[model samples]
Target: MKTKESKKKRTEIQAVDLFCGVGGLTHGLILGGVKVVAGVDLDSICRFPYEANNAAAFIEQDVKTLSGKTVRKLFSERGLKLLAGCAPCQPFSTYSRGGRKSGINEDWELVASFGRLVREVQPDLVTMENVPQVEQHPVFQEFLSDLHGYHVSWSVVECSSIGVPQTRKRLVLFASKFGPEGLSISESNRRKVTVKDAIAHLRPVVAGQADKKDPLHIAPRLSDLNMKRIKASRPGGTWRDWHPSMRAACHRKVSGDTYPSVYGRMEWNQPGPTMTTQCFGYGNGRFGHPEQDRAITLREAAMLQTFPVGYRFLKKDEKAKFSLLGRLIGNAVPVRLGEVIAETLKSHVAFYASAEKRECA
Candidate 1:
C-alpha cells in the first residue's frame, strides 16, 4: 500500500458507499478527490461493475446487516469516516407499481436501519440520494429527526439542470454534525444537455453492433415486431402517430390513455425521458433513440448518468450483458448529481474544520 502522503495526495477524504449499485455515486465521489473505501450492496450482479469502475472493494451484503464494528473497520486504517448511501428507493419511487402506503412497505424499515448505522458509527458527515417521493415518507422524516444535533439540508433536484442529460429528478440530503444548521446549494442555471448532445457523436451502428473502439457501446437487439415498430417511430413521436396495426394492445385499451409515454421516441433537442431500470426495452418507456433505429444502449445510459466514456464497468472477458448493465446504469444516481452532493459536503467539512481551529486557538 502507498504511504499516507500519497493517499492524502490522491484524495481529499475517504467515504463508504452503502447500497452502492455498480458504483455510479462511488465513481463520482472518486472523481471529486474522495477515496471510496468500500461499496456495499445486496445485488450480486453489481459486484463485477462496481469493483471494476471504482477502485474499491465490493461487499455483496445487505445493508440491514451492516454493523458499526464492520463499518468502523472499513475505515480503521485510514482515519477517515465519511458515510454516503443511496438506499433502495423502490418503495418511494414515483414509478412504483405498488401504490404508496406507509406501514405495509418494509423498505421504510431499511431507512431507519440506515439511520441506526449512522447514529452508531457517527461519521463526520452523511449524504443520501433517492427518489423525490422519499421526502414524503414518514420514515424519511423520522430519519431527519434522528439527526437532531446535526446540520441537515435536503431538496428535490432536477438532474438535467446538473448536466445529467436525462430528465430524472431526485431528492438529495446532506447532514453534518459539526457544520452550520444547513448548507445551501444554488440550483444550476446552465443550459440543459439534451439526448442529442450525449449520443449524437457516435457512429451509427445497427442494433447489436459495437462501436469500433468501445465494445460496451452496443445497443440491444430488437424483435422483428419491435423493429417494424421502431421504423415507424419518429423523434418526439409516439405510437399515436404509428399505423393502427403497430399499436400495442394496452395502447388500444381505454386504460392506456394514462401511459402514453411508452413506445415513444425521444426528441433530439430535448432531454431524454427519465431512465428506468428497463430502459433497454424500447417498449418500456420513451427508450427509443431520437434518430437511431435501436433502443438506448448501456453505454448511452451511462453517459446520461454522467459517467465518462473511458469508465470501465465490466471486464473484456465478462459476458457483460446489456439487460443487467442497463439496470445498473439506469437506476444509478447521475454522477454529476453526486458531485453536487460532494460539493455540499466539502463546503460543510471545510466550514466546520475552520470553526474547530478557531476554537482551539
Candidate 2:
C-alpha cells in the first residue's frame, strides 16, 4: 500500500543502480532528473551515504545473490525501466592486469552476474561502466551476449572528456530495446577543469593535520623517507628528479624508471592521476600536493573525483578515516561523469518518445 503510493510520485522513467558504490551514479542520475528508486550494493558501509545523500533505499545484497524478481519488484510496472551498474572493475583494471593484483574469484564472475540479471529482467535501457580492458575479456563478451536483441554501443571514455579533473579511463556500454540507434553520450564540450581550478582555493593544511572546519581536509602523516622524497619532488617530475641515493630500490631496477609517477607530484595545469583506494598516501601514485609538503587531502581527492564540496561521507562530525573514505571516494563514479551519463539518457528517452508520438499522430 505505502509502496504503491510512493511509486506514484516518481517520474515515468525509473532506475535501479547496482553496485551503487556510495551513490555516485545514483546521485548523478537524480541530479539529471531521473528518479532513482533504490540503489543495490553489497557493502554494508555504503548503506548510510547511499541512503542519506540520494534519498533512495540502499539494498545491501551482493549482486550475485540478488534475484531478478527481487529487483523487478522495486520498479514501477508502468514506465521505462533502466538498469545501471559499475561492476567491480579490479579484475580488468590496468593495475590488476599489470600483475600487481586481481580481484577474487567472485569478482571475476560479477560481470556475468550482471548479465544474468539483465537477461532475466529485460529492462528498457541498460548501462554499465568499467575499466576499458573489460571489453577484451571473455566475460565481457558473454555479458554482451545477454543483450542479443537490443541495440548495443560502447566506448572507452576519457574521464577528462567529461570534465573530471582526473586521469582515468572507463568503458561505458549502453543497450536499449528502442531499436537501431542506441543511447550513447559524447564528450561534454564544457571546458576541462584543471588541478588548480579544482583545489587551489582550499586552505592549505600540512602533513598530519586536519582543518578545524573541514575534517575531511586532513592529510596523512608522512614518513621521514617519504617526507624527503616529497620535498625534493617537483610538479610533473618523476623519481628521476630525486638524488640517486634517495630513489627507491624498485626505481633503481631496469624497470625502476617505468612507473615514475610512483613518487611524483601532480602538475597544476593537468588532471591528477587516477584516484585509487590509497589516494591519501603520499607514496601512492602522483598524489603529492603540487607545492605542499603533504599529499592531497581526502577533500581534494573527492574534488578531483568531482564529488561536490561538503558532500557528506560521515555523520555530523563522526570523524574521518583515511582508508575508508579513500576507498569510497576512489571507487565512486565521478559525480560529474554520472551527471553527463544521466543527461544523455534523458535526451535519448525524450527524443524517442517524441518521435513515437509524432509517428502515432
Candidate 3:
C-alpha cells in the first residue's frame, strides 16, 4: 500500500522531454514513476521507437522553431509541469567543438533556445544534462542566469556511481520552484554495474554474423586487416599489445603511439568507457567484445548505455544500419543516468509535498 501511494504521488509530476532522442531519457523517467507526457525531437526516425517504447507523444519538429506557448499547451492538462532536455551536445562537447566559442554558432543557439523555452513557460521544474565541458562556455552562464526565479543545483555527475555501466561524466542541472534541498542528485548504494553484468547474456556471434533470433544483434563486417588485428587483441588490451606488423600506420607515428584507447577491448569486470556517436565500430573506441572476435554489436552498445535488452532500435522489417544505430544509441542519455535524475525529482516532490501536508495539518 505504501509503494502504491508513493507511485500515485509520483504521477502528480508530469514532464515533456526536449531534444528527446529515441526516448532514452523518457523511458528511464517513466520507469522511475514520472508521468512523461510527450517527447520532442527533430529526428523523424525516432518517432516509431520513441512513441512505441514510451507512452509519450513524439513531437517531430526542430526545437529551435518550437514556441513556448505550444509546449505550455501540451502541459495544460494539469499536473506539476516539468521540462527536461539535454540539448544536442556537439557544440558544447569537448570532443567535437573544434575550438568553437559558445553563443555564436547555430549549434550553440540550441542551448539558448532551451533557455528561451524555460523563461517563456516557467515550468515548475527543469533539468538539463550534457557533457562536462559545457560548463566552461559563456552561454552556460547565461542559461544559469535565466533561472533567477528557481533554485538550481548542478554538478558533474559520475554516472557509474549511480548504477550506469559506463565510465561517463555528465553535467547535470536541476532547478525547482519548490526549494533548494531536493535539487541535488543522489547516487544509488548498489555496487557498480559492469560489462559482464550488462551484456553476458547475449549469445556469441562472430564478426559479420547476424543472430537469427534478434536482427539488431548483428555486428558489422570487419575488413581483412582489422579482422586479424581483433583476433590478436586481448580483452582490455590496447593497440600497444598488437605486434608491430599489425599496427595501423598512424599507431606507429610518434603522437599516435601515445594514444591507446582506440582498437581496445572492454574489461569484463570493469565498467565500459564513455560511449560515442561512432561506438559501433571496433576501432572507434574501447568497443571490441571481450571474448568475441568482433566489434561490440549495436545491441551490446545500447545495453552498455543501460537500455533494456529488448529495446527496439529499428521497426519490424526495417534493416539496421550500423552508422544510424550507433548515433541513436550512443547519443542517447544513458537510461540508468536518466533513472537517477527521475529518482531525484520523485524524492524531491515527496519531501516538499509531505512538508506542505504537515504545515496544513
Highest lDDT scorer? 3
List the global CA lDDT of all models.
0.78, 0.84, 0.85
Ten contiguous residues with the weakest lDDT in model 2: 92-101
Candidate number of the best TM-score: 3
Clashing pairs in 1: none
| Candidate 2 segments exceeding 4 Å error | 1-11, 91-104, 188-190
- Write candidate 2's Cα lDDT for 1-361 as tens digits: 2354433332256899998978988988888877899999877777887888887899988788999999899997777899998888574432233334456555668889899999989998898988898887789999999999988998988988788899789888888887545377787767777899999999999899998999999999998999999999999998898898898888878987678799889999988889888899888889999999999999999999888787778888688899888988888888887888888777777777657657866
- Cα lDDT tens digits, model 1, 1-361, are 4466743432356799998887889888877667789998878777887887778999987788889789988985543468898877574331232244534366767678778889888887788887788888898988897677878888888888878888888888888766565375567888889988988887787886777677778887888888999999888777887889888898889998888778778888999988877887789989898878898777887887788877787777555577667767777878887777777666666665556557766
lDDT of 3 by residue, 81-193 (tens): 89999987584332133244544467667788899999999999999998797889888998999898899999998999988889999999999999998788876677899
Estimate the lDDT of model 2.
Answer: 0.84
Clashes of each: 0, 0, 0
Pairs clashing within candidate 2: none
TM-score rank order: 3, 2, 1
Off by over 4 Å in 1: 1-12, 76-80, 91-104, 355-361
- Order of the predicted models by lDDT, top scorer first: 3, 2, 1
Model 3 CA deviation exceeding 4 Å by range: 1-11, 91-104
Q: What is the lDDT of residue 310 in candidate 1?
A: 75
Q: Estimate each model's TM-score.
A: 0.88, 0.91, 0.93
